[model samples]
Structure formats: structure tokens, C-alpha cells
Target: MFQTDSENDSAEPHYLRLRNQIANEIEAGILSSGARLPSERKYHELIGSARGTVREALSQLEAEGLIYRKDRSGWYVSPKPVTYDPTRWSGFMTYVAEQGRLPATETLQVKTEKQPPAILDIFGKGVRNPLYRVERRRSIDERPVLVEDITINPALAPGLARHNLNGSLSGVLRDVYGLVVTRNHVEMRACALVRHTAECLGVKSGTPGLLVIRTSYDARGRVIEYDQEYWCANAIRIEVDLTVA
Candidate 1:
């Protein structure tokens, strides 16, 4: 059931009343996580408000991290954020599972291509050197949350093209290629999701998103892998533990 702005809610913005009502329901578990909300028209009709007012209220909730919009799909109550620690050398499956969530990965593309100019500069490789590139979409609890494009130095992981990439690449590198990510350099920023990446992650293009670029090094300090990951802005909670020397 929805409520209209009564005497108690008279002083506040109409949308805020709706936003608060929805948020209260979510916090009280009336609207469970991953639950789809009513369509804009339905919501507005229920509340006896304009569609624009309903939309504004939903936008406020989204900005508060209580809900999210899926491209071509209706809004949903955001699931618990997956905590990510960039300093840890861990696999996607590992962290997701640790949080009691199901993790799935879909391989989007695999190819051997001439080293990209940026990759070449990082790897210090010849222009002719071919790198193995893999693009993947990863999901938690059936919601696509990340799209990652990764380039691997073929010289470091021979026969990598033959492995099943739908699983953890970190696992494959460790078990098959005998390579370990001893150290890594990670950079993160807020960005507008590109069309292709947004589509892959099931979000609207130009949505504010999180970008993480990581370069992994082997024990010998060789650049083993470079990857860029695009994430749904509300789908993850980045947490890092630090100790001062």
C-alpha cells in the first residue's frame, strides 16, 4: 500500500514523502532486495502523483543506494553490495561466494590480437607481439554486475587460449600456467559507462559507473596481466584494510 502526503508529510516535498515511504519499506524488508518495483505509471497511479514525481522519488532512492535501474528493465531494490578489496589477490568467484552470493561468469570474447598500444607500452613488447584478450560479463545472484576486458601476455601463459575462460582467470593462471600475482597496481575512478560496457552490464549507457584498471605482476615482477573492469555503481562496496609501516 502507498501513502499520499498527509498533514504529517505536508511540509516536505511530495517526492520526498514517496521516497521515504519506499525507503522505509525497503529497510523493513517489505520490499526485499532484488525485488522489482511497479512500473512508473503504476506507481504514480497508486500514489495519485504525476509520473514525473514518481520518477523523481525513484531517482532519489537510487542516489541513496537503495535502488537501481536496469536498462530496458524496471527498477529493483539493490542487493547487498559485494565487498571488494583491491589489495587482495583473489578471484571474483572467491569473494562473491565468501559473501554468501552465487557468482557466475559468461565469456564474451576471446582472441589473439596485436598488442594494443597501451598494452605494448606496459609490457614493453614489440608491435608484432600478439596478446590474448578476453572479455567477460560477471554476475552475482543472477544480476550482471561487471564487464571486464583483460589482456594476457601470451609469452607468460602459453596455451592459455585452450582453457575455459568462463571460470576464474586467476585460477587458470595459478593452476595451469604456474603464474602467481605476487603484486598488483590498481587504479579506480568514477566514470560514465560506455554503450557496449553498459549493455554488457545491463545498465543504461552514460550511467555513472565505477572503473578499475589493474596490472598484475608475477613473482619475477613481469607484467602478467592488465585488465579494465566496469561495474554497476550500486552493486559493489569497495573495502580496503591498511596498516601503517
Candidate 2:
């Protein structure tokens, strides 16, 4: 289905032609989500195009969010990204579950570390003592979607590490520590996945992704948690709602 003829007299650029052909296939449902694409060499051979042309075509598709690449594996059609509303007070698991998707968390590492300058800057006296650092990989319906690095003030929840860390941190804070999160200051940006993040998310380094930095505050206006979350660009769609008085 991907084969192209060299003698075809199309005026379009080679890469554009290839990209459009692949896009048409995806649109027609000939290539479904999660379907692995042909290897670069195979695609080049099938289309009789230059290797660079095939690579460029695939890269374009990836940028358009139609395809994704794994580290050692080739490209695959991407599933529809999940919709997320940062303004909502709901936690990740709750929101994902509401969307009819199963959400799971795997605790990768947990330790106490000296508060970084950035964290200290955000929390100041609130984070004066050593911070409890937790790295977790979050998945939806068995597909890894994001990784989060969370820092907490140990003083607020002593012996927190002894409890199950795979569950909701927000739930733990509210139920166990009696710290109800009342507000979140969030900052979002588009970024490429770094090596470690990419490895954790099963994507190639430099893959396009979203970065969210969140500072959670308790009812008393004390910073309770600082969270850095990296999400696959193809796996999330962010939405915001505003009302004016």
C-alpha cells in the first residue's frame, strides 16, 4: 500500500508527496492506531525515494501527532490524546477514570534529597528541611503516558515513605496527613523529552512532549507539594475554560 512509482509525474515535492500518501492511509483507516510502520529502510525501498526523503516524511507525521517512535522500534500510528483540564481539582486517576480509561502508577524511586534551589525558591521556609523525592511512571490503559517527579516536605507527612506510594499522592496527603490541597499554581511549556524521561516513557530522546510544573498548596496556603510532570505530546490534549464576570 505504501509503494510509489518513480515515473509518477506529480509536481509535489518528494517528501510532501510521501507524507500526504501516508496521511491518506491513516485517514482511510488502512493504518490504525498502534499499528507499527515499516522500517525506514523498508519504506525508502518501497517508495523508491531517498532515505532522507522517507525520514523527513516520517518526521513530519510525528510532528503532526499522527505517529510516534519508540527507542529501538520504528514508528507507529498514535492513539487519540487524552483531554486534560488543569483547572479541575480532580486528580490524575480520577480524571482518567472518568474518561473510561484505566490509570496506573509505578513508583520508580523514592528518597530524601536536599531541596533544589528551584524548589527552595518556590517554597522557601516551607521546604527548609530535606525533601522527600518520588519519581513515578504513570500509564493509562497500560500505555505509559507520563512520568512525574514529586517533591514533598517530609515535615508535613512524616514516615510517608512507609505507605504505598503507587497510589494517589493527593489522596494520601488528604486522608493521612489531613492536608487538603486547595490550590495549584501551574506552569506549562512545550519541550522535547530528555534521555532519562524518554527512556521512562518508552519514546525516543527529543520526542515532543509537554512539561507541567505544579505547586500545590494546602488550605492554610502552605506549599505541600511540588510536582514536575512530563507527558507525551501525542498522549494528551490540554484544555482550559474561562468565565468573565
Candidate 3:
């Protein structure tokens, strides 16, 4: 049902024309989210273009976040990314729920490790404390989107490893330890997906993504947790509210 004969008259490159045709179909609702795209060979036949041309067009679409590829699987239209507000104090489940999407976390690993230099710098020198390292994969609407590595101060919340780590850590800190997170110091930057992260998110290494480092403090200004979260760039949209005095 999709044709590009009329586009041949244009001056655009063959791949560009093919890319625009597919993009138009996606925008016009002819292709739905999660819909599998035609195979590269099939597309070449349909558009009367070279196979390499079809591949280039698909690669372009993937780079633009209009589509994504699964390992050993072909490309599919990307779903709309989730909107996130970093200023909000609520946890992942809360914000995702507000957007009418299901949220889930899979705890990958939890163990004790010596405090890293960066964390020790924040907590101050002369402190010898063993920290709990937690690794988790987070999903929204059943789609894997984020991977997190959290370091917890055991002195602040002893026996934290005994509880379920798949749920909200903030909730556990508040309800069990009475350590409420009052403020957070956060830094954000663009990063490429590492091997471990790519395997977890089912994406290729070197894919562009967002990296967030957050240090949460309790009411008394005590550092409670240090977290590093890697998010698929196409799976989230970051928003912040700003005010000028």
C-alpha cells in the first residue's frame, strides 16, 4: 500500500526519498507504534532502489529515533518517549503511573563494596564505610528503558540489603529508616551505551543515551544515596521547571 513513484521526480537522493516516504507514513498513522518495518530486501524491491539505499534510509530513521532495532530482529517504529521531570521528588513508579504507564524494576545485583572515591569525596575523608551497591533495570509499559547503579550508605540504613530492592528505594528509606530525601544534587550529560548497559537494554553498544548522577540528602543534610542512571535517549524526554528571580 506504500508507494514512492511520485517521489522519484524530486531532486532528493534515493535514500532520502525513501526515508521521507517511510517517515510520512509513520506520521500519517499508516504505520503504528511497534509495527515492524518491511525487510531491507522487501523495501528495495518495493521502492525499486538498491538494497544498500534501503539500509541507509533505515539507518537514518533509527538514528532519528523514529525506529529501533532489536538484536537478531528487524526494525520497528519507536513508541513515544516517556516525559520525566527531574525536579520532582517522587520515585520512578510514581511519575510513570501519573503518565498512565506501567512501571517495573528488575533487581540485577546487590552486594557490598568499598566506597568509591567520588562517593567518599562527598561523605568526607577519614570515613571508612562499606557501601551497598545495587544494580537494577527499569521498564515503563513493559519496555526496558533505564539501568541504574545505586550506592547506599550502610551506616545510615543498616541491613538495607535484606529488603526487596526491586521496589522504590526512597520509600524504604522513608518508611523503615525514617530518612526522608529532602533534596538532590543532580548532573546530566549525554553518553554512549556501554557493553553491559547495551545488553541490558537490548540496544547496540555506542548508542547515544542520557546519563544522570544524583546525590540525595536527608532532612539533616546527610548524604543518603548516590545513584547513576543510564537511560535510552529515545525512551525518555527530560523536563525541568525553572524560575528567575
Worst 10 residues of 3 by lDDT: 1-10
Query: Each model's C-alpha lDDT?
Result: 0.86, 0.88, 0.86
> Per-residue lDDT of 1-245 in model 2, one digit per residue for the tens?
66576566878889888899989988888889789988899888888999999999998998989987776788989876788998888888898999988899999999999876877887766467578999999999899999999998888999988888898999998899999888899999999998999999988788889998999998788888899999998889999989996
Model 3, clash count? 0
Looking at model 2, which ten-residue stretch has the lowest summed lDDT?
Answer: 1-10
* Ten-residue region with minimum lDDT total, candidate 1: 2-11
Ranking by TM-score: 3, 1, 2
**Candidate 1 lDDT tens digits, 114-157:** 86576788876443477888999999999899999898888778
User: Which one wins on TM-score?
Assistant: 3
Candidate 2 TM-score, C-alpha based: 0.81
lDDT of 3 at 143: 88
The number of clashing residue pairs in model 2 is 0
Clashing pairs in 1: none
Candidate 1 regions off by >4 Å? 1-14, 38-52, 63-65, 68-75, 125-128, 241-245
